[model samples]
Target chain A: MAQSADAKAYNAKVYVTLRPSVLDPAGTAVRSGLSHMGYDNVSKVRIGKYIEVELTAESEVAAKSQLDKICDQLLANPVIENYRIEILEAVAV
Target chain B: MAQSADAKAYNAKVYVTLRPSVLDPAGTAVRSGLSHMGYDNVSKVRIGKYIEVELTAESEVAAKSQLDKICDQLLANPVIENYRIEILEAVAV
Candidate 1:
């Protein structure tokens, strides 16, 4: 791709996980399913959402800050879930 | 927790992502939402599933093998989605 004068691209991998203290009904159902399938050793399972975001910004710092804001505002529920953001490779767009 | 004579605990973190060629409507929706929020620089976005599984096994290798099978059979749609598995810290149960 041709480089744009001001286009800086960054990829963010965001992980949203439920708090450990909360009950996970879906996870429990999956666990029960595993047990029924003879995987009785399986004990606990937790399900969460994973998001990959690609954006352009002026700098890596700017992309990271924006990703944090996005995660906080829309990607995750702060009251019951915790989100972690990892900045992947950045490239010029 | 008291140790069980034969219980070996392993945690698995799995990431499931759609193949690059596939269309991701959910991701596109999120991208549109971000653009509405003034993040015009945002380009590509992908949405995936994250799962955490805790199990008891004889060894890490055993747990990993089982996890691979689980991901293949239930956790991911192998035809369109790719999955990566990471074996987290193992502990005696």
Candidate 2:
């Protein structure tokens, strides 16, 4: 039997946080919920989303452009939040 | 009235994790660094990355396709980690 080929590999990390001046209703709600859930020791509660993606792209440039679009157009709120991206590695699939 | 109009708004969240079997040297180093930094109370420290992007798109479908390409191609490691995407909102730019 012959071996099949693999897809390209890449890694991206994204972080989201509420803007300094904007009130974070969601965070406040989570904290309150935690307190009600019996987690009395929980001093602070900030809720954020985390996503991981796997893809095959022709080059790093194309990959980055696509990643940036996702962050700006779908995954983050610019009005009240700030974010950053990190590239972990580029490896063969 | 002077209004130049706004650009479309989108948000994304990306999470990266080491494959269960692969040793996380980077994470280990950070944990060790924290211990040396006099934060001995910190335990089981895990490190990850986050990104925020802004863009303009014609429609939601196009936006989704672009976002998926970003995840599968750039933002995630398929071998060791799994990822998910969230769309916060679609507003006029």
Candidate 3:
């Protein structure tokens, strides 16, 4: 659920990452390619996605809960990925 | 709108891009930096976002429309960005 018209505005940054146990071949390929291209100082590499979502919500807690539902039930693949979300901006109704 | 449990499984790859007229300083920085670092093959640069979404949808067309709504109304800044979505996989119900 989102929010009613009277709710405040909020911006969320959702980060999705592959689970530690999952093999990220794409990330590995990118890192190896960078190294070959002379970026020797580069260390470990992990690939993730960044999603920015805007919502109108009643409160921070309510907003976070709604976002969690979106992530767990709709966005990220729970079996292979873990996600973290941060509230980037909040504005009064 | 999504599909019922009896629908097929669909995976989507959504690409979000800044409109051609929009300024992308971050992309500029990356491209210039890469050229300076010897990736001279690079020409123009535009920074964008990619999202992978999995869903149960009745058909490809329905899934695409749902994803379009999500992108146009929720995910992208229509004033400055345009988006394209591709159906990557589909499995029987």
lDDT of 3 by residue, B27-76 (tens): 67755764565434334445566555665566778778766866776556
- Best prediction by DockQ: 1
Lowest lDDT sum, 10 consecutive residues, model 1 chain A, at: A1-10
**Ranking of all predicted structures according to lDDT, beginning with the best and ending with the worst:** 1, 3, 2
CAPRI classification of candidate 1 = medium
DockQ agreement of candidate 2 with the native complex? 0.03
Q: Write model 1 residue lDDT over A1-93, tens digit each, in one string.
A: 233588577888999999988888998998898878778888889999999998877777877888888888888988899999988667566
The better candidate by lDDT, 1 or 3, is: 1
Top model by lDDT, which number? 1
Candidate 3 lDDT, A8-50, residue by residue in tens = 7777767677898998887577457545654332334455665
lDDT of candidates 1 onward, in order: 0.85, 0.51, 0.66
- lDDT by residue (B7-88, candidate 1, tens digit) is 6888899999999999999999999998888777788789999999988777788889888888887889999999999887
In candidate 2, position A54 carries an lDDT of 40
Winner on DockQ between 1 and 3 is 1
lDDT of 3 at A75: 58
Give per-residue CA lDDT, model 2, range A1-93, as digits (tens): 111364345665556666668775665664465456543322333445443444344455655665566567655777776766665555775
- Model 1, stretches more than 4 Å misplaced? A1-7, B1-7
